[model samples]
Target: MSIENTLSEIRDINLNYLMLAQQMIREDKPSAIFRLGISKDIANLIDSLSNSQLTKLANAQMMLARFRFDDCSILNMLTSYNKDSALTNAHAVMLMANQPVEAIA
Candidate 1:
């Protein structure tokens, strides 16, 4: 694919991610903060963004959302299939819960 197409796709993804994040934050502040792995300040910033601001931010070439889990083990646990899905998911959540939330620089 062309670079322009790739950039357009990235922008679309960013817009969708931002919209969903804003909804999540508005509906449930604490849950959104934990799920997004972001600090309360960042969540507030996201929540306060206007539609034009969101579009402007989303137009950036780079992605806005990112994987919260940096550890291979956690990633593997989430991706791997297991017969005991419930237990595995619970374990993964426990590990993720221990991870530090992303703070605004």
Candidate 2:
């Protein structure tokens, strides 16, 4: 609806994502890296961040997390309704697994 509302929602999502990521990383570093599609350095940074730091970062206007896929085909395959939903989803996952993880510049 309003810009302010949208931004607030983004901040909420960011906070939740960060919290979940921290938990995931703590539970299983390798699995978290793969699931989050983040580099080891980034994962370490996220794991080390204090709650206050996470809150401050989440308060920023822009979203902190993003979709892993930029490919139209992957997006389409994931979103489109298909009779073979399991197979289609598996295919999407396979494609995403090959996509590069985010690396710091």
Candidate 3:
């Protein structure tokens, strides 16, 4: 895909992720922190952002859509022998982000 298209897709994903994080914070702050793997301070910062701020951040096209495991060994440990389990976990993340899991793969 063209770079512009890729960037647009990233922006859309970022917006959706931010919006879901915002809702999770409002509904269940602790759960949001746990699920997002974010510190309370970061969660509070996310919670404090207005929708406009979120939109601006999304438009910046620098937000991440998924976490990258730092260690290859960790990734292997998590998904080496159980592909189904890995897929289920990924689907759960999509659900949490309010995205259709099927749309992902």
TM-score per model over all chains: 0.93, 0.90, 0.68
For model 3, how big is the CA root-mean-square deviation? 8.9
> Looking at candidate 2, what is the lDDT of residue 82?
100
The reply for model 3, stretches above 4 Å from the true place, is 65-68, 82-105
Q: What is the C-alpha lDDT of each candidate?
A: 0.93, 0.94, 0.73
Runs off by more than 4 Å, candidate 2 = none
RMSD per candidate (Å) reads: 1.1, 1.4, 8.9
Q: How are the candidates ranked when ordered by TM-score, highest leading?
A: 1, 2, 3
Clashes of each: 0, 0, 0
How would you encode candidate 1's per-residue C-alpha lDDT over 26-58 as one tens digit per residue? 999999998888899999999999999999999
**lDDT, candidate 3, at 61:** 56
Q: Residue 95 of model 2: what lDDT?
A: 93
Task: Kindly indicate the candidate among 2 and 3 with the higher TM-score.
Answer: 2
Error of 1 at 59 (Å): 0.9
Rate residue 63 of model 1 by lDDT: 82
Predicted structure 2: lDDT: 0.94
Model with the higher lDDT, candidate 2 or 3: 2
Q: lDDT tens string, model 3, 1-105?
A: 999999999899999999998899989999887677676777887899998999998897575556545445455655566759767566545544452222112
